[model samples]
Target: MVVPAQGLPASVRIHEVGARDGLQNEKAVVPTEIKAEFIHRLAEAGLTTIEATSFVHPKWVPQLADAERLFPLLDDIEGVALPVLVPNERGLDRALALGADRIAVFASATESFAKANLNRTVDESLGMFAPVVARAKEQRVHVRGYLSMCFGDPWEGAVPVHQVVRVAKSLMDLGCDELSLGDTIGVATPAHVRSLLAALNEEGVPTSAIGVHFHDTYGQALANTLAALQHGVTTVDASAGGLGGCPYAKSATGNLATEDLVWMLQGLGIDTGVDLGRLTATSVWLAERLGRPSPSRTVRALSPDSHKE
Candidate 1:
């Protein structure tokens, strides 16, 4: 069996989408400046990729309703890529006007989710985004596509593999720098992950073009990530403090915790380029500000090995 290879990465690129993906579903409205500070701390911790906020209307997602104001505060950082979620032309316009260096467009794998989330068919959603991707390309802004419900869906049971490939191909064909495959309901298993990656590989999809985003709803997030790593997938999306959920999928939980993913990767001798200890501290700080215990099991574990204390 293959492994993630020993030692540290020259530098692993982890795009912390927690502020956007992780916090979007939250009930509380985090202050705009506070969100800026949260992202600042993430960068200070060496996370080069951070998804700051979505350019969607506040009525749709009140948590990230501050995408416009939040954009400028996070832009001056030199090394980090502050990609905002552009829901359509209007959203894309806002991002471009703000000089966003990178942007993310989203589409779902199933029909029900398409209507519920995007109010359009899958094909329609892709068609709508073609121009957006072109515009981003024209302006030299990096584009990333998010394919939601690549695994099981809350409304549609047992997602077919073909559906995932179709959307992936559409996104990549449209010039997206990368495509993030999301297990929206956290219903994926390692077996499912391996099969999907294999299919994508056989279809000539570069692993470099792929990124995995999982939720630990059933506690299998790390196991699924291990499968992705074994397949030579380099990029992974994680959330600090594991803050996030599917806005439409009510049962969904937080993302695969960044602290948890880092803890496991470091333990396996893989090169993630992250300081797990500092990540733990950051998680603690975020949880305090959010007034909740962190969902990261690894963060909790390091909290005074009562035996050691």
Candidate 2:
């Protein structure tokens, strides 16, 4: 039943964000123990790059306030990469103190978002991240730059491709090892996705160094992801069970579901090293803890209760 795709990569590296981005927006803080177990289960389910937590201030995202406590519990997990989000130098310091070698800095593609999210102008925020990226690179830490609102901004409406390219190039110039283009409000269509990738290529940003992080706000996450894959982007940012939405962008919804992405990749005969059944089960287990059904269609379809009625 597998249909091979002509242009897609043979294998995709899924950057699982369930632990950090997924739980950060939750009104109810998931306990440190549960968060640790969630990450452990994700590793067991074959997610090699799991974003463990953020080192942002507790006042900003209280849900992940237990990052200090949660990260230590994941020390015994081997073979999987645990990347953390560092908002500033202090955040980076905290993550480094906990032995985190991989970190991501979130950036905005539009001025509206930059002001709303970081309380600074786009250039100012980049200036803030300059030293952080420089410091991380000094220690040989892998740094990923997350460019949000690449396709469209809630306040700015349609984002110019050139504007995105400028910021993306800036991040790479800051010595980020990789860049994850985020459709923060999920307004990206397939053509928009392709155009942006092509534009980045024109600006000397290779497709191999870019990753795609799409939201399902318009139900275009999968479609957009397909466009990125066809462009030779191998890294994908997905949340297990579709568990995350932007806390800053009110219009943004849950991220592309890992289960949904896995199903599509499996059908396309792409190797992701993920066990779909185990991944679905872990999402189901976490849904129970969150006291709601998983928003992911693939998870809901394969879940045990789906067959009950």
Candidate 3:
């Protein structure tokens, strides 16, 4: 018997960051089990790539102090590739010790953001990535790169497209599997997204190697994502329940909401392989756990209906 054939799926790779980058700065520390389960639930929902935890120092980000505790519990979850952030040699040693399957390193596009956010110059930060990427490659672990302030910087205002392209190309050359372009301050417009992507494309960075991380401060995240998608950005970084903010940015809100992004994709005839009802429920669940209103409009719209069923 032959199964019915369908048209090409509207493919998109969404990188869920709620557990690490999303909840890094939460005032109340989420339990290690809850964080782990939240991650498990997302993987069960068809997210292939999830940022599970970070190995930064406990004194630096107290909320994620449990990376060691939470990381090991996630063993043997099929179909999901868990990657944790490693800021330096110390962090890398810890993750490698834990047998991390993948790792990510970051650098800022602006000099001020580089120093203030990571306490290093752009050159120094990129320099650090060299060894880390090399070590991860030795261990057969996938390495990813993050270029923060790719769209706009809080301290420096508008970031140059040249800066973004240079950093992205440099990271790709450093042996990164992919690069996530972060709008740390939520100040990027559609025009900004387009211009940056155009510059990268001109520089010969394959569209497949780029990802977008947007914040919703001015409600431009979704719009910017649309612009990015139009320009061939197939990978996106979003947080469940809109769960994160940039600790380095004074007034930025959460990253782009997963439910909202999924909604937009569904409406535009894209296949995300996500259960909207479940995703929305999880968003609301996390928001309620945090004692805050949800940052996702799709979650609000769908949660009650899912419960009615």
Best by lDDT: 2
Candidate 1 structure quality by residue, lDDT tens digits, 1-309: 224555334334687988898888778888888788888888877787889889987889988777778888876677888889999999999888888879999999998899999999999999999999999999999999999999988888889998899888888999999989999989999989989998887887888888999999999898998888877777889999788888888878989999888777766666666777777777777777787788777777875432131
Candidate 1 — which residues are off by over 4 angstroms? 1-11, 304-309
lDDT tens string, model 3, 71-122?
8899968888899999988899999999897999988899988998788889
Q: Highest TM-score: give the candidate number.
A: 2
Mark the regions of model 3 whose C-alpha exceeds 4 Å error after superposition: 1-9, 304-309
Candidate 2 or 3, higher TM-score? 2
Flag clash pairs in model 1.
8-271, 9-271, 22-243, 22-244
TM-score of each: 0.94, 0.98, 0.93
Report backbone clashes per prediction: 4, 0, 0
lDDT value for model 2: 0.95
- The window of 10 residues in a row where model 2 has the poorest summed lDDT is 300-309
Residue-wise C-alpha lDDT for candidate 2, range 1-309, written one tens digit per residue: 799979789999999999888899999988899999999999999999999999999999999888899999999999999999999999999999999999999999999999998999999999999999999999999999999999999998999999999999999999999999999999999999999999999999999999999999989999999989998999999999999999999999999999999999999999999999999999999998998889999998898594243
Global Cα RMSD, each model: 3.0, 1.1, 3.9
